[model samples]
Target chain A: MNHSVRAVDRIAPRRQGNWDWRAAGNFVAGGAGGGVLACVAALSIGLGFDPRLLLAVGLAMMGFGLTCVWFEIGRPWRAMNVFRHVGSSWMTREAYVALFAMGTGLLAIGLGTRPLVAATGLLGLLFIYAQARILAANKGIPAWRHGRCLPVVLSTGLAEGAGLVACAGAWAAWWRYPAMLLVPLCAWRVIAWRRYLAALAADGAPVGTLTAFRRINSLFVWGGNLVPVVLAGVAVLADAPILAVLAGMLTVAAGWQMKYSLVCRAAFTQGFALPKQPVRGNSRTGPGVKPGWQWNRWLTD
Target chain B: MKRYAMVIDLRRCVGCQTCTAACKSANATPTGVQWRRVLDLESGEFPDVRRSFVPVACMHCANPPCEEVCPTTATKKRADGLVTIDYDICIGCANCIMACPYDARSIIHQPQYAYGDQPIASEAARMDSQHIGVATKCTFCKDRIDLAERTGQIPGRDPEVTPACVNSCISGAMHFGDILDSDSNVSRLLAENESFRMHEELGTAPAVHYILDRR
Candidate 1:
């Protein structure tokens, strides 16, 4: 998995700066929270009923994610400034949307209003979109900046939310319909994830990143996507409600794993690049130096 | 309309790292933080190898990615083409640090001195606690340039008004001037010599140019 070459430490890497575990956790928790709310809202509006679990769990997850991000900031007192950049920064917009989603969702659940629940669900989707953009806007990280990142993130959130609904559906029969969507959702996620990795390799991004994803490919593909699909299939075929709940839990866990690796492990910065090499005497021009990703490999290899 | 730029002559540079030392002292940077750096690159096979020193800092691009991704609009590019971060408003999210392709911006997590916990008097005077936990980079000595402008002195020409790295370069490898001005030294060099910017294909339009060595 060590695809990069290391050299001397004269030049620094840009990837050192970014959203760490707290940020990754925030995406997972918030996406799951909003996704759950959206699913519940749809169920309530379409079926003239809502699951209480969706309302409570969704908001709780979103709140937990926000709290994690809050703790991650170096300056806690200046946290409120996250709202100042709504016009430009996706992070700001995500914050505002999260607030709106929470407020409207709470009101919808408190008042037992179907229309309000629908609006909250729509806002929740918007919140997920904002989170996707927040990562994509980081142009330095080639893996995160690819076009597939948005769809992959959004679909995983939807799938995780659906899985949650299916798991909760074990108690309530009405939750089974959303659970059925998990297989297709997982399929979409796997496709998108594969496409993104291929694109990264094709674009000649850091070899280390390629190797890292390759090493973890089986986990993401089989553990995250395939396993959930099989479990959900078995739950449906065997008519076992308990098995359905297990499938839902597995799907949710897989979604979290995908995001955790994407934000923390797969995330690498576009290090410094020299377009032309400095020449001396009559020697042929040498290859340009890339210090950020290759430094370690250059030293050892 | 005045686009200030720096042109470093690769032939004249001796890889002394005097510019790195001068920049550290001038900025009073933290222990791990360096606003300017000299990278020594060794190319070719053992017997035929050649060494080149590349002095790097913030390129002050015309289209700056750092400013584009700043959540709080804290990283701003002035009309003179210098990119600066407003520490008071910065939330220390480190977004700009990731956005910058140059590896220019740094987030100071905590206070650290050259020696240890207790800093000397001069170091203590320069240490701004407020700067901690915010994105910071080379300002190209904006304070000195501002003072020179107010005092009716040319920025690149005046020894006291220029960047510390440019002033400290003993081999005269680094030259600073307004590229847009036809009469400026950098403009003349840019027109005459074969020069190139780093990662020009990225469309950053870096203000720093390197004059390739013919000898």
Candidate 2:
């Protein structure tokens, strides 16, 4: 146990800081990006999907999202009780919205009702937005503190929703309209990525450590932001559904990477100056012994 | 409608983690898990050395981010401003964990148990253990509050029902009361001291306040 403790103590410490904006930005990107992919997949299955099936899928996604949340929490079983604070807790509000949205989506599917689906879809969009807003509310995280993040996330949701609708349209051979929506959504994604990148480049560096900031810029700014932009452009030009879907997939991966970089890298360090060096004796000594020098040497110097 | 809040004077908080230990025991938090934590924050350098102990727990904010990101409506706040979790409905989702800025929440994926002789029945222990995989946080001892209220002893008004952390504070640095009440000890202290929240800029309207060491 002592040896293990010593070993653990020897491990190098990493930088600690807040990367709220970056995390929020990436979350927006993921929700919007993943939403688009899901929409595309739904469309590809044909708009005639059984309302039940659609509801099931949507609910499943919500459940999966919940699992992610639970995994991140300190106590999973206690999570249910959080809803008790729905009136005051943003978490409760988000949870209620998610549950309501899933239920609505499920009901619409079960009834094969267009109005219900639309309502559910709208609620779903809001659910995603609520997730974004939750992160954006944290001003301590500079990356997530901007007004633009909320709008950007909302737009991403729209784009992704449109893409899903388009996939359904494609299967139904009703491609023209959904494609029109996808074009703008893809464009918005590009613009948002650019803006996020610019912000990160300008302010990514935390107060003290240069290494962590550089890592953030290189990993997130380049890998997450740049790669996705290039891939998205190629997909747009290809004008192929497969290409678009592939680009969307890459975008999600990049977004996750961005999130990881933000979480692992951002930190705050206390600043301090080094102490002055002490004067040394003039006389040289053996490796094992202290140096001995005459007092006269100090006087002469 | 009780409004519970904690005031921590950073000056006298020795970071002994007694409050943390007391919170864990009161809450029965698992080993290697902490309901309250003390952070050792060092600033400046060498001759200008400054070290501060930051003891943290759930802020029980007026607007909690964890509540906003839950998809299953599992996490909630009480009328008394205590943020709590319901184990039964939780789907093991970690959305709230990502949403919290303070990292106050933890997801229990595995059951924890006492190693000594079983004082409580196995069934009861199993029932308690079933709360695994749900999000957990400091409840400000809601169970204690409930017990006290039932016995005609409301916390803040009665010393017996006060939170374990507040009662165990040796330096009188930890204060708990209603932030809404004008004459409450917490409010009076805030009025007299230069107080600040951990992340006031976030605007989550945290109820927990801090008084830093001016000296």
The DockQ leader among the candidates is 1
Q: How much is A176 displaced in model 1, in angstroms?
A: 1.8
Native-vs-model 2 lDDT? 0.55
Q: Could you tell me the lDDT of residue A21 within candidate 1?
A: 88
Q: Candidate 1, residues B61-156: lDDT per residue as tens digits?
A: 988877777778778889988888888999888877766667777777778887878987887889888779888899999998788768978777
Which lDDT tens digits does candidate 1 get at residues A50-144? Answer: 65557879888989999988877768788888787676788888889988887888887788787778888888788788889888887667777
Against the hidden reference, what TM-scores do the models get?
A: 0.92, 0.61
True contacts kept of each: 0.44, 0.15
Docking level for model 1 = medium
**How big is the positional error of residue A148 in model 2, measured in Å on the Cα after superposition?**
3.3
lDDT digits (tens) for residues B85-170 of candidate 2: 77767655555655565657666666544554343454344335645666678888788777776897756656678888888888
